[model samples]
Target: MTPPPMITDRDRDVIERYADGATLQEIADGINLTRERVRQIVRKHGGADAETSRAARQAAKEAGEQRAQIEFLAEYEAIASNLAHQGFTRAETVSRISVLYPSIDVDVADEALRASNIVFDQNNDTDVFSNVALEAGVWFLLGSELRLKPDYAWAAVNLPQELLDELGTHLSEASVTPDELATVLGIIGAAQNAAMSDPTLTITGARYNELRSELLDAIGLKSATGTKPWPPTRQTLQKRYQGWSDALEAMGLATASLGRPKGLLAFSEDDYANAVIDFISAAAAAGAEPTFAFYGEWVKEQAADGTRRPSPASVRNFYDGWLPALRKANAVVAARSAEANLSVE
Candidate 1:
């Protein structure tokens, strides 16, 4: 049983406002709560029937429209300016913009770029970029810049190695270290996961270097997913993270250590709890039982859903925490009901 949220006088005022004809959305916007949460509170307090005034509804609509327009204009200007300096292929521009501003839809950006008559001057000098065959040794990454950077694409070259070597040096198990592979992939995954900024807070240099070093190791060792064992198209670290579980599992690599993921970024208690609750709620909504096994399977299931995935450590913490809390609450409620029945007799 989940415990109730602590409601103060401010919460009562929000309900009162909704009962007096303010929309649940308006109340939510004003009080910084989600509309669903506001609606739940209003319903619990018998305020669901109240309809907001037409004027208030119009005002809310206008506010939303205005905010959207402002956002669109800002996004358009930014993309147009970027296209002017970093003139790239249409697809590359789209990918670059998407990586930089993750919230911006690729299609929407593409349409806007076309409509704005913004043309990208192709990188004519990329012809100077020759394909260098990556030897099976550790490669060093000197900078923090990632795949989106203009120079980043040139850092690690994926050359043609279709001609299998009799020595089996390329794409061979003798050269692959599963533990090292897991560690590097974990770090690269963590890098892409942490590397985003616009909407995300910045991480520390120490953390950044740690991730960079692992990526450097992969690049140096030619152990990166696409360049080494995996397909060449699996070039970006993002690709590896996208195929994190599957690729590792397919290679018969152990993921038990990846579960702890301390080599990655730091996650807070609130973040962990939220991830746990999200999994439980989503599972329940899907009509699936929220067991450890169910969540474990869900986590391993293929596809990058862009959700804040929990670690094995997080799963254990959730199991040890929420289950006991739920049972204790249930026991308290049962005891209270029993006491009330006895008093009535």
Candidate 2:
């Protein structure tokens, strides 16, 4: 026959402190008890065996870590899958993933594995998957119970296939084609170029560099190969322009006039309208725009002149003025293109 469990005064004290929201560490400190000893008492009184409690805590920690890993892997998979869908060359995908997930070395390894056609079979029947599934399932069930969203129920109820198909369809619609994205990128590049060229456009050097790099990347332009302080390469600029031109053609707009200097400045009615809409949408979503900062000897001069205080109005004005003009120009060009098409017809 099993011996009856011991009910010591220390056990009662630990339970009371736990009920009062004292953490295991805190409870241990208060009663001059070690954390392990306190944990033992709490488990015994709470109807858990010492071994069972240790296992439970270990399991919980493992589950948390696995969840985090899953989320990371899911994000990595998303980027790879998106690039694949967008018709990016495998090399391009690898290059882009390397830049995006620099910290996640697994991406680099996975890319190599994918390139080499080395496949590893995942054992679903293993303890890892079973623990992960149990934890994830519990979370989903609890969330569904609280929110009562039919979609969550559907996710939980359906076989993995149905869920996968639904997810795929959603992803497909959201996936941007390289050509389509390149056009939007082209416009942004033009805007950045205009900003950098205009003496009136007062932005921080860091912000300018960041925006310039982003624009270069969007158009598939490479940064300067060496450490020289020279301006961006002509070849890079040309490639970016080509990307933009391609995007313009894909959008059903005439590229002939837009491709020429001062071409974007002129527009037809339809083009003008579309440009206005696109500009407005882009401006509204311009939260991602980098902020420029000022420093160096100018900072001391400004401090001495009592002009060091940042002005919100100056920042707001830049966005308000430049974005509107770009939008109007784009619209005008679009409208003119439509008219030219009609004339040709």
Candidate 3:
């Protein structure tokens, strides 16, 4: 037979806390017991385990969601029927419902209505619904007070009149695409961030690439889904404008340097140079010469040890060419060696 659990005061405290809705971890933290020990004490005292409590909560949440969705559906059907009786098309009904009840998930309503097998008047008002929803969405997102104002946040409270008018024109049309909206917002965001510090700042293709992440973060365009669209990629921008240079020209920005763009910009030119010089030094210590072929493997090794090294391409771009990079790294290595020898002397 198993020995009964010791009925200590701490055990009683754990049981009482668990009964009062304190989680095992919480009880354990208060009475200085391991979570597992607290869990055992609670179970021995006829209380539910953490897993059981979690499952119950999850089940309740799912049931509540189902109930709410059912209620929404019932209301949606009644309103939709009333609208149809008034000779409104399904699209018009959807648009009116979206405007009147901004809290409702219009897409969910649309899907539920479409699945209900109810036929209504047919018209080209689908685009009418699309236009209304798109216009609302653009303003809701861009005008949201909750949007983050990172270092690169735009100083202007509102977009330029020309861009605003262009967006308005797009929404006024019978058709609109998320891609079109994304492109407009992307260009405007990029230009604003570029001019944040200097109004006359020029955004060349390379500079644009360097600031891409910061621009996207400032504009809150991190992830894209099927219904949601993100800022256009570099390839998309280039394709849209016929070439990188043409794109920069369209934006009225110019490149100051002809050198290829470096990665991440978090790493400086010296950071890249130092990485190559360090590699050359380590290779010499191992009786080898650092070459382009071995640099990639060396980077991988550094990564394995949790040290980040700049990409080989970034290093080459920083120094202009492979030979020039080697010569610079060798020169640095020689200077360091000479300094070390002088110190020793």
Candidate 4:
């Protein structure tokens, strides 16, 4: 500014070197200035030229975003392809989507279809069975649903937009109707709930009962009691118990037994408790007086509290009422089978 600040020879030399393609280090060395100082000077004087650095930085950022988008699309495509192969209905796909992406927009199906790169023929039925695609579709759809849901907004924001578009397209082509999709979704949701409800014990009480019945039938036990004139000794009971135990073991159930002669058979605390109730009911229906003494040792082992074994009288009162009904049902079945055989002859 003061006389336009006399241009020093050193500055002129530095400028000349720079103009000749000398690097900032070379110019700094020539001017005896730090590289940083040289760069600052270059930038200050460069004016419009400084925009090159900013533009480069912006380009790098955009490239990163693009790469992310590409990756997301690839992943989504893979997942959609898998679900489509698995024969998952559209409703199942949507349900999986809702589960994975709760914040997904209601209109995602249309949007995804529009954005998908996958091509399908008009004749390509969505109902066409595909095990692999169905499985993969469920997972991708889950992700898509998560993307639109508010709760998954953060995930949606992080996901590349291209992926979202691709997923939308893939989902749109699914043949499964919305209602069918909902049922599948409900099933998946129920399974998840069941898993969460008891991570350690997945079998339900009803399932246990069915398994128990199957095991009993396998061991030739018409009922828990030996009333069918089958062997009733301790060894016979043990053999039957062992058979049931083996079967349950195969099914991964932990089993145990109690009782001496005509004693009560106990499973685990949970299983045994329920079995006892069932036994009492069965006894009442069978016209047999249920006796606690019949299961005295077993009950005592289960109680472990040293309470006196329940009296035979007490057992009879508890179970005597139900035996008659069961006996009648048994007689009816036997007679029907006999008549059927006679008719066949």
Candidate number of the best lDDT: 3
On residues 200-288, what C-alpha lDDT tens digit does candidate 2 reach at each position? 32322233334434433454332122111111222222243354333222222223433332222333434434433443444446532
Error of 2 at 180 (Å): 34
Q: Order of candidates by lDDT, top first?
A: 3, 1, 2, 4
Residue-level lDDT of model 1, residues 1-345, one tens digit each, is 966666779778977676555777878889899999887876665544644544555676667655654565575666654543332455677777678778876666665555543434343322211222111110112113333222222221211223123213433443645544433333333332232211122323233335433543455433422122221212222133344333222222223324332222466544555555556666778887455456666665522565556665564544332232223233444677799999999
Candidate 3 per-residue lDDT over residues 1-345, each given as its tens digit: 988777888777777666555677877888787989887778787777666666665776667666666776787788886554343556777889989999987766776666554444445323222322322222233323224232222312323345445454543342445554544454445443433223234434443333443444465433311112222233344444456554443333333434344454868767777888778777778876466657778988999999999887777555644444665666676788899999999
- Model 1 C-alpha lDDT versus the unseen true structure: 0.44
Worst 10 residues of 1 by lDDT: 133-142
Better of 1 and 2 by lDDT: 1
Question: Least accurate stretch of 10 residues (summed lDDT) in model 4?
Answer: 224-233
The order of the candidates by TM-score, greatest first, is: 3, 4, 2, 1
Model 1 stretches astray by more than 4 angstroms: 1-12, 15-62, 75-78, 81-95, 103-345
Q: How far out, in Å, is residue 270 in model 2?
A: 63
What TM-score fits each model? 0.19, 0.21, 0.23, 0.22
Q: Predict model 3's lDDT versus the native.
A: 0.54
lDDT measured at residue 74 in model 3 versus the true structure, 0 to 100: 84
Clashes of 3: 0
Worst 10-residue lDDT window, candidate 3? 223-232
